[model samples]
Target: MSSENQELRKVGLKVTLPRVKILNLLDQSDERHMSAEDVYKALLEAGEEVGLATVYRVLTQFEQAGLVERHNFDGGHSVFELDSGEHHDHMVCTETGQVFEFHNDEIESLQKKVADELGFELTGHNLVLYGKPKVN
Candidate 1:
């Protein structure tokens, strides 16, 4: 069995063509985060006949199954990326709508310290920064 099949089975999702194709697309794409329209366009470019609604359905299913994560950025934009099982914050470019993932130990420590000072144990956090590219 393929790795995609194994992953689906592990996630308690029955393996199907659309699911496998979508999973492969997500894994192979250069852009980590993609909207359903982006996925549909890519599928069309690849000569796949998957419908937009089907892409949305499959992406939602993947999100529910913990196979992917959905991030809603500013301007009503939403994107999905494979859940790589790592904790990372995001930076979105306001001009390009691009997403960047990063982790900073100092930032993490500061957050923890702030939470501690507030008399709260930080259980979870989602941090997103937005800015446009600066002209040199």
Candidate 2:
């Protein structure tokens, strides 16, 4: 087992084939954000026998353990992504619900200034920009 798997096991979660498979899939996906149905479909496409409920259960556990982060975008559905351990913000495609991650030093400085003016410490924040793609 890999170090990540060992850490998960140490957290009291059983080492199982399904959990490992799901974790690997999330670890390798490009988009990083996947819904329960997305994971279930991937498992079926990969010929895995895990059920949708199991996928959801494991994702919930991962979220509670800080191994994953879940987001509810403008679309009603939820999406889960691996925790990158870096602080950044999100930009969501309003038309398609696609997400992009970005960080800006200017924005961070402005946020600090605003917080200082308000006499508050800027611990953390979530900035999600929702908009349609520009036409060519």
Candidate 3:
């Protein structure tokens, strides 16, 4: 069986064409973050017979299956990325709308400390920093 099929089976999801295509697209995409519209466009460009609604549905299913992560970076649209198991934060460029991933032990520790001080367990958290690039 192909890896994609195995992944679908592992998640208890039936290996449908849409699910496998969407999963492969996300996994092979050079851009880590992609919105539903972006995925739809790519599918159309590749001559795949997929609807935008189907793309959205597949993405939502992937998110529920823990195969992908969704982020509402701009508070307007949500982008999806494959969940690679490693934890990382995001930095968004306001001017260009580009997203970058970063990992920092200090920041992680600080978050844990803050949560401990507040007497709340840090089950999960998302940190997104927005900024514009400086022009020299």
Candidate 4:
């Protein structure tokens, strides 16, 4: 079985053409984050007969299955990316709308400490820092 098929089976989702196609797109995309409209446009450009609504539905399903992670950036738009099994945070460039991924042990430890001080277990957390790129 193909990797996509195995992923679908592992998530208890029946393998389907649209699911496979979307998963493949996400897996192969150069941009880690993509919106539903972006995905729909890519499908159209690729000559796939997928509908916009179907893209939205499939993306939501993937998010629920933990195959993808969704983020609502400061732009008030949501983007999806494949969950690569590593925890990281995001930094968005406000000027160019670029996204960058970063991991910091200090930040993670501080978050844990804050949660512990509050007597709450940190189940999960998402940190998004927005800034402009340094210009020469």
Candidate 5:
């Protein structure tokens, strides 16, 4: 079995052609985040015969396997991204629907301080900032 197939087996997912295609597409994405529709379009553009439903199914499996993360942000449909094993937050552009990831030490320190004062130990958090660009 190929390494990719082995990974699917390890995650308790049955290895299939459509699943492999979706996994490869997710692996090759520039931003590593895509909606099901976007992934379907990508597969069509690449001449892969995978359907939209297959893309969604494969993404769901990948999410369950800890190979990907799904987020529903700002009333938009859910987005899927490969798990990169790093901690960060997202900033969304309201005007253009773009996303940027960033991290700051000062913000992290402040969060810890606030949690400490509240008598709670912080285990995890998600912070997303949304705004439109300033008109010049």
Candidate 6:
């Protein structure tokens, strides 16, 4: 049994061809984040017979199974990335639409401090910064 099959079974998802293909694509792709259209394009390039609708459906299933995380960025765009169980924030380049992942302990500490000062314990948070690369 392949690891992808095992992963799906572990997540209580029945292993199907489309699910396996999508899972493998998400796992092996260098671009950690991908939209459904991006995924469909890749599958087509790879000569997979899957359809765009199936890609959307499988991605939603993955998200529900906790196999991936969905981020709805500004401009109403959404992307999916495998849930690696590590916490990190994001930065979106306004011009290129590139998503960058970052981790900063200082920022994390500050957020916790602010939450505590507000009489609320921090349970979770998602911080996304948008920017344009410096021309210089």
TM-score of each: 0.95, 0.91, 0.97, 0.96, 0.89, 0.97
Best by lDDT: 6
| Global Cα lDDT for candidate 5 | 0.85
Comparison by lDDT, 1 against 6, better one:
6
Runs in model 4 lying further than 4 Å from the true structure: none
Model 2 segments more than 4 A misplaced: 10-12
Candidate achieving higher TM-score, 1 or 2: 1
Residues 17-136, model 1: lDDT tens digits: 999999999999999999999999999999999999999999999999999999999979679999999999999999888889999999999999999999999998999999989899
lDDT minimum window of 10 residues, candidate 1: 70-79
lDDT of 6 by residue, 1-136 (tens): 9999999999999999999999999999999999999999999999998999999999999999999999999878679999999999999999998999999999999999999999999999999999999998
The full ranking of all candidates by lDDT, starting with the best, is 6, 4, 3, 1, 2, 5
The per-prediction CA RMSD against the true structure, in angstroms, equals: 1.0, 1.6, 0.9, 1.0, 1.7, 0.8
Measured with C-alpha atoms, the lDDT of residue 41 in candidate 2 is 95
lDDT of each: 0.95, 0.88, 0.95, 0.95, 0.85, 0.96
Residue 33, model 1, lDDT:
94
- CA error at residue 56 for candidate 4, angstroms: 0.1
True-structure lDDT of candidate 2: 0.88
Clashes counted in candidate 6 amount to: 0
Candidate 5: tens digits of C-alpha lDDT, residues 5-111: 88788889888899888877888788666889989998899988987777888888899899889988886699988887897889889877788889999999999
In angstroms, the error of model 5 at 7 is: 3.3
Query: Residues 1-136, candidate 2, lDDT per residue (tens digit)?
Result: 5866885786677778888888888987776889999999998998999999999999999899888889888878889998888988899988888889999999999999999999999998889899889999
Q: State the lDDT at 54 in candidate 4.
A: 96
TM-score of model number 1: 0.95
Tens-digit lDDT string for candidate 3 (28-51): 999999999999999898899999
**Model 1: per-residue Cα lDDT at residue 62:** 97
Query: How much is 75 displaced in model 2, in angstroms?
Result: 0.8
> What would the TM-score be for candidate 4 when compared with the true structure?
0.96
